[model samples]
Target: MPILKDFRYHAPVGVDEALALLHKSKKPLLLGGGTFVLNTLKKTAAYPTDVIGLRKIASLHGIRDAAKEVTIGSMTTLAEVASSPVVGEHFASLAGAAACVATTPLRHMATIGGNVASRFFWVDLPSVLMALGAKVAWAGDKAKKTLSVEDFLSLTGPEARGIVTEVLLPKSGLTGVYFRHTQTMEVDLPLVAMAFAARRQAGGVKDVRCIVNTTLSRPVRLTGVASYFETKKVTEWKADEAADVLRRDLEQGKLDDYRLHCLCADLESLIDKFKKA
Candidate 1:
């Protein structure tokens, strides 16, 4: 069995206390449910000297719905988000993505904050949140701030170190779909994942956003393909044309041909469903 290296554990009850602990520690790592951090420390040689648990912070534990937006606390578990009626009704794709993460047990333990903060490419939430145009609110010793999900995903090192407080989803009722291609149905990391959102205007797609995450390091928005789709009539859109646009934008040779083909086919199917709706 893998063992976690020696570390001092601190549980802070408030955001200010947590931030103070984080700033004072020599090598502090934030803990939210401890699914990702604990597992990594168990299996990997790298470890932090201090582990600061955020579970004691009461503010980071609930979902709040506003007139124009919905805010989900970072410490809220994947299971909570998956089963939330508000989330399901407003952002079905995000709910679906949350439900599909790992298994029942892991979902119960994996917090949304930990999942987003880790920024693991294989994870499902990041891509769907990005497609939905969500914003992330974070706090640190310096100050609290917010960033677009796209911008948050692109950050690295110190820029991404703050305590993720909540994820804000816009109330705009856009249709979205989340697709994950795994080798088996029995809970495994996806070979390719895609999340797409589009608004229909005058029977044509408008405000389109498509995010793709493969075996690569991070998910990226396929702006070129989204642009192409925006120009075509929803009813007139063809699968082959969509595939060709994705193929060109993705630079065909970088990914395994078969996997890319499957992704393209799935994306076409997703678009077809949107067209029919």
Candidate 2:
């Protein structure tokens, strides 16, 4: 571990106390389980002196379901989320994704809010959350605000001006799947991932969303892929046609032919399985 200079640490018991500390502190960093932050500290010179731990705040934990939405408190652990019957029964994809994170020991120590707040391109939760159209509710410097997951991740880093309080996911007719591809069963992070959330429509596909997460940058929405499925029958589809279309239009320009071909192949296989399900 790196040597750190002496600094004040604060543990606030409520949202009001936490917000007040955030407003008053300079260059303060919020501490959840410290899985990421602490690891970074040991490897690099970066460490926050003013740490404001959110663990003391009873309000910022657990999963709760209302009639219309499911709310996950900011400090809720990944293990807790994975074990939640509400998540498993109602949000299978979310539960599966949480259960797959790191491992059981790490999941027990990590928080869902911390996972999303990392906003790392390689992380799986953000992409899955994007497909679910989750919204983040936080206490901003000026006032409380809620922003779409997309908007929240667009910040330079985690929002320094706000303390993320909860994540709200709308409940309704939505189906989702998360696929992680890696070279090894464990240890290796996902080389490429595909996440999808969509609603079946009477005529065809409705409200389809596709996201791609890479280790290079933040997770990106594959909107172009989703567009091809609109009004198209899920059963009768051409993977080649979809691949060719996406290959030509990606904003990143033409990917290496070999890599693109492999990605398309995986995509086709996954979609076929989803269609059958």
Structural similarity to truth (TM-score) of each candidate: 0.94, 0.90
Question: Residues 228-272, candidate 2, lDDT per residue (tens digit)?
Answer: 877578775678877766675455844455445556876697568
* lDDT (10s digit) by residue, model 1, range 54-85: 99899999899999999999999999999999
Runs in model 1 deviating more than 4 A are: none
In terms of lDDT, the poorest run of 10 residues in model 2 is 253-262
Clashes of each: 0, 0
Q: How does model 1 fare in lDDT? A: 0.86
Whole-model lDDT, candidate 2? Answer: 0.78
Query: What's the TM for model 1?
Result: 0.94
